[model samples]
Target: MAVSALVHLVTGGLVVGGALLIVLGWETIVQPVLGLFLIFLAAELRPRFGKVDEERLLRRAGVPRLFALLDDIAEAVGTRGFDAVRLTQDFAISAVPFGLRRRRLDIGLALWETLTPQQRIACPARARGHFAAGDVRHNLMVRTALPP
Candidate 1:
């Protein structure tokens, strides 16, 4: 993604510079290089410039939404326990499974401030592991928790 962004920026600069050169009647090998740079830039950037289809899915679902989602997630897993969730960064979120069977969903600042010591330790591992694994689904769980 970073490469794509860099290419796009460089290519865009070259295209603009090339156009300006043309307008000034400055015909030189540089113009073609600039133009080619732009094409190459676009090609390199194309992959990163695509639309993000996961925005809705990535959204924090908020407290109410989380409640509903976690409720379902926990129930699905047959755990009476749930996890406390948080949005750790711009790109992803985290959650730590809790409860007997870990079927329940805790959310928001209020719940976060009230986690037990064990929950706090366990939460971050879950969230971080999920993020490292590139699983957006795990992002919904609490990766960190507050101390009791």
Candidate 2:
């Protein structure tokens, strides 16, 4: 957390200083270019989750069968359960916690459709396991410190 804060502070300072140099009418093209680069870096410094989009989110009513399958998996895996479900075209399955009790599950349709039934079960189980394993890459603080 401290590292992320320090990084943000330094990046903010660079952005401000660069903008000031450009505002003051620097003698060379270097100042403007550097300013633009710093601004871009600031924009890409942290990844943010977008607003909830219902169209992409799977509702239990809309996919009760799929939800049932997940529930069975969750029970077997000994996890509480997922609160939200998202479908993605990318070939990946991941879960991220939000707001203490809620976990958002992102299911990649491409890989899902290609897997065998047994493999399909294993995929999500593995994703949940990754989170349970306490991987540093999954930490919010470390994630914020990384560039998008």
Candidate 3:
């Protein structure tokens, strides 16, 4: 099994075991109430489907050079390309994967415009690496399971 799945299993088991100990060891009336609350909390933690705004999708921009740079960077990182590019105001570049097979290359317009050609290529390259590596921080399930 994958290490990611194993981590989740261990975490889930620990939580459930702790809850069972609390329910079984405690003889107070609130024990059942706390158990029910834990159940509801667990139920609420199911990963939800992600939705992207179609309006933010980039069909084409006037900057051919930027697009070419993007193509080169993507090739360097071994990804086919982004399905869509989403412009953001956050001043950070990231790859956002939504649904099953769709990915959005999130470009922070403020930072993109300020970066040098080489820096622009570098930033996206790291984001691509994150997406490609199945990094824990980049996994939606892992992200959702942890507390913010």
Best by TM-score: 3
| Model 3 Cα lDDT, one tens digit per residue, 8-103 | 665566568558856695778677667666656655654444678888787446556656776787888887566678889988999877766666
lDDT of 3 at 122: 93
By lDDT, rank the candidates, best first: 2, 3, 1
Model 1 TM-score (2 dp): 0.26
Q: What local distance difference test score does each model get?
A: 0.42, 0.73, 0.71
lDDT for residue 1 in candidate 1, whole number 0-100: 40
TM-scores, one per candidate: 0.26, 0.59, 0.60
Collision count of model 2: 0
Going through the candidates in the order shown, the clash numbers are: 16, 0, 0
**Root-mean-square deviation of Cα positions for candidate 3 versus the true structure, in angstroms:** 5.4
**TM-score for predicted model 2 compared with the true structure:** 0.59
Q: What's the candidate order when arranged by decreasing TM-score? A: 3, 2, 1
> Model 1: residues >4 Å from true position, as ranges?
1-12, 25-43, 46-51, 54-148
Worst 10 residues of 3 by lDDT: 40-49
* Clashing residue pairs, backbone N/CA/C < 3 A, model 3: none
- Compare candidates 1 and 2 on TM-score and give the better one: 2
Candidate 3 is scored at a TM of: 0.60
